[model samples]
Target: MAIFVHYLSILLISAVIFLLLRAYRLRRLRLPPGNLGLPFVGETLQLISAYKTENPEPFIDERAKRHGSVFTTHVFGEPTVFSADPETNRFILQNEGKLFECSYPGSISNLLGKHSLLLMKGNLHKRMHSLTMSFANSSIIKDQLLVDIDRLIRLNLDSWTDRILLMEAAKKVKRNNKSLVGLGPSRLSSESKMALLITFELAVKQLMSFDPGEWSESLRKQYVLVIEGFFTVPLPLFSATYRRAIKARREVAEALSKIVKERREEYEKGERKNDMLGALLGGEWEEDQLSNEQIVDFMVALLVAGYETTSTIMTLAVKFLTQTPLALAQLKVSCWKMSGTDFKGKNHRTVVKLLDDVIDTSLPW
Candidate 1:
């Protein structure tokens, strides 16, 4: 009975949409030139169905072939355009003006917090981007961050750790290195390390809600819960979980407030530091213009985005090298051959440059 009602509701809505689309103001949409009609179920089934077979590359290739380098279509009830051309990508990324604006589906915005630079628009987006680039840019990364990565590799191997699950072992090594580099010499225990892993898991689940993937029916059904209430919904059985996390962060708040107060004092005495929180609370942002909630939202967004790509790259290096034993051995030897001073010295970029060359030459992609 419910299934019958679902189909009936869909047909009714589609008819109404089709009629409205043919109305004078929306007449052009009735003749919209793009992918052919997908019917009441829309393109959701086609997308998820394609993912069921492990590889969706062929489907994407077919669409690209039919549509050329840049073309448009409808998916998940929205108009989507695809571009595989480098020039088109460069244009979208590099040439930004009033004409083009970035936006995501309303569903996604409801999940991720507000003011995230990834989801920001126009002037607000530009502001957050400049503020974040202060910390993310390579030029500002500490020399110790690079060296500690090498030390982390050695320490992980030295732990005697019996032949471990390669995935878990890889994560352990990557976690130590990322934390040290990102947090400026913060010491963390094994448990703290696992917290980072859990955070990434939650974040990936957040990204996957509308990511067009095939999973068990169970996972797909859970998407509704995950996407709708990431911030607002508190887990009932989890025992005041969100509240506790909020309470715990007050300590971090006091610390930030102290730092902000000190920075003001220092400015009165003529001094400055370029730390992320400092730059955010910098005079240009105007203390009154920034709310505490906004600061926390920005910090949480940074922490989530910062760790994901770093861990993925670290895992990529391990996974790629493992498949090519000779390359793995070469990397180990090369890393050792570069004495500790290599990065700080004239050949500072040499290690990353060599890795880039290795990635270009060796990656199966």
Candidate 2:
């Protein structure tokens, strides 16, 4: 029994020595300090859990505390190096082509398409960025898209009143035999909340000039599905979120392709429209025009960029406004000062007119 115990102790010590030796050899090149967690999954679950929290700083904070500003970890099933140092991050971004090429997670690249502007690198990326930026510049917004956005916002707000059953939008003012209608809801309710979401969707639709009859709602649905799984694991298992996302991505590509075909017919007939898609198809870029697939990818990228972010901001802004009285009061005061209206109006045209007035009167600088 004593001899058996002695051999067991020797085996344990040998295993420990072997592991230490392996670790040292692995770090012989002086890699950043951090744990890789486990094989295959690595620290993906931990990263997801940390980001799921309201305050995600602690995940990095704890690591930075132990391993310094620059460290390594396995996240999203990739061996990743995280730099908390701003200068280092800037250096990496500025020297992207030289030091490291731009890349995305497998899930995102798969869902957004390998040809997406976000995933592209080198001279091709620069050309794509330039083309897209030309369509989204301040001059274009002021001249064309802003007018469309304002119109859509008014229409969406008007439609909202009809959809909501739980909120009263206007009050009756009676003077003797005459009845006068006062504008606006007294407070935010469940109905207004629903209206806000629809307004955002409508705004995105009109801004992008997606065909209102068929493609708008279907495309929106597919885009939403793709977005919901953009950060999920890129597993191809049956009924997986990633699988659904890939399917939705293909559907979106099909829809965009159809639209591109229709637009081509419209261009042939000399019917030029005032939307991003129309501009892209009609614009004169003699040598470097985008192919149909590239245009579709760009449109998808643009839609994903604008839709999710704008909706999220509106949702969070409404939430915080309702929860924070002081902030709400400041917003009301600022809006009134900027526009000279209290935003209490039942007529969509009236609200739009007020906005136009504000824009007309504002200083250019």
Candidate 3:
């Protein structure tokens, strides 16, 4: 019986190898050129390298030059297409709603819950968008979110006089902003502040794992595990039995729940907040609208979406300053100019220009 089992294993291994080779040969014959790595794993290693190579854009552009605008490559286990041609990109980016629907990871609904409008499709998005218009207005933004944003910025700027570590500074900057704007109030009790900070850090860590570079297969698996807990169905259920998605999924949910509860109370008492949570709470939905758990999930999704992008841009700005001395000097100069600028139309455009120039330079190709 044992001898028979050993032969069975050998046959199974041979079949798998044969299938992989067949796929490789077929792709080579027809598909676009690419650095196809190992059979199943492919260039996943390169996509997930620990020590990222500098000038990632050129690395991608170089590949595009060799392999046209639209090419196929296997990263990890999935076949992904890189599109850069003007017409194709315009179609994908502008018409993601019409031509194509986003396939956000199933894990997203797992963590953020099913009720988030971000997860909502089609008419649902249009419906919620109608409500969003009221809160998205300039007056509402200035009153609720921007004031907190400036307050957080001033706090961060005051925290440093001469020197600070850029990455660490960027972190504190995110925390300060999250607490002030995302958390509904600048001043929260110790419990709420710690929860917000810890949860925010965990969520960001999971999301930021994917930097553009070569990724190792092992690292990819573990990294996915770290971030996978919040999946629509815990990833483990798909792989083996059940496994929880660590605490990130739960912590974010809890923090969101607290925020929603607080906002509801405040709104009940006649205090309006600026963040998306306020928009969501104030919006009209169907008879059920959303449950508290689901609302927490939506808030978690929003927090990750809104906050991470802002923090990343700030991080990119700091990284840019490291290379360019003139840029660093300009950041200081810009800060000073912002302080002197009045809150009026003419001054606003200049303030915007200063920000725009810095941002445009800092952007990655």
Candidate 4:
């Protein structure tokens, strides 16, 4: 008992000394104003709590009122500086490699891999960003992607009949004794699943010219695990979700690596497809000659980004459109006009222009 007590005292003293040293170092530098909250855990619980509520802005709003747009706080086992100012964010992005480095929590960084576009820096990031942008340029969208998007939308929409309630469909809720019950073992809402399927299918098609198949479907299932664990506590020892995510991430990377190698071999054999993978493999630029590992990481990051944000936005858009009769009416009218015109010739431009106008006027950004 005496020996155990002695070791505990020593550990406590070491921790105090470490914290004191850290505090002294921090005192030397000028940091933004804000409380760090409790040591280690910090204000993460408060942040999470606020986000769980209907309105999360109060957490930031109260902090901004107390301090400013930029304030210091600790979250996810690290000290962080929060910037709510638009100009400050713009400046940080503009000078990313030079003045700032993108730092995410270990959970995100580990799952995304070191070579992910989001985690990359300097010239590598610039090269990859340029490549991605070139692939997504307006000409490519209009000439290649838009037709696929239209077809996918129409295909999905065919199931939406008057018998199906929009809210119930969006929530994946079923009526049982006048009460709503969630569907599926995963518990993912119907609208979210639909959005994810659309986005994932489109991403795979564009990236590797992969059609909707059992392989792509299997990959998408793994991605659901990865996405679900993104915001969870990063303790794999204690968290089954994190553990599942880590396993899923590894499987995804391995699968993508295999595909990348096969695609490279195909390109060498003069078998080509006009997809992002082909561009990376066959491009003349030295920078475009990425390794299989890099390509896998890039694809994983892009898949996560494309599906998560796009699906959330799509689900919310559907929800809002259902709520707003005026916007829904305008959208329906625009769709009716599009249905009458041939989507191949001059009418293509007209349909695109009409869509642009509808999106501009109907959706509240």
User: Can you give the TM-score per candidate against the true fold?
Assistant: 0.55, 0.67, 0.59, 0.82
lDDT tens readout by residue for model 3, 1-365: 99999999999999788668767776777876666555555554455441133333654676789888877776534556778688988888888877888755454455456777678777776776576566456564534333334544554455455655554554454343322221222443332333333334333322222222233222233323334342222345353311544444555555446656776788769886545565565646434455677566555555455443554455555556555778778878878767854434665556557768778866752
Pairs of residues at least 3 apart in sequence or in different chains that clash in candidate 1: none
Candidate of highest lDDT: 4
Off by over 4 Å in 3: 1-42, 57-68, 105-118, 129-133, 143-146, 161-246, 261-274, 286-288, 315-365
The candidate maximizing TM-score is 4
- Return the number of clashes found in candidate 1: 0
Candidate 4 residues lying further than 4 Å off, grouped into runs, are 65-68, 85-103, 138-141, 158-163, 167-189, 286-288, 323-327, 340-342
Cα displacement (Å) at residue 53, model 3: 2.4
lDDT, residue 257, model 2 = 87
Q: Report model 2's TM-score to 2 decimal places.
A: 0.67
What C-alpha lDDT do the candidate models reach, one value each?
0.50, 0.62, 0.53, 0.75
Q: After superposition, how far is residue 16 of candidate 4 from its true place, in Å?
A: 1.9
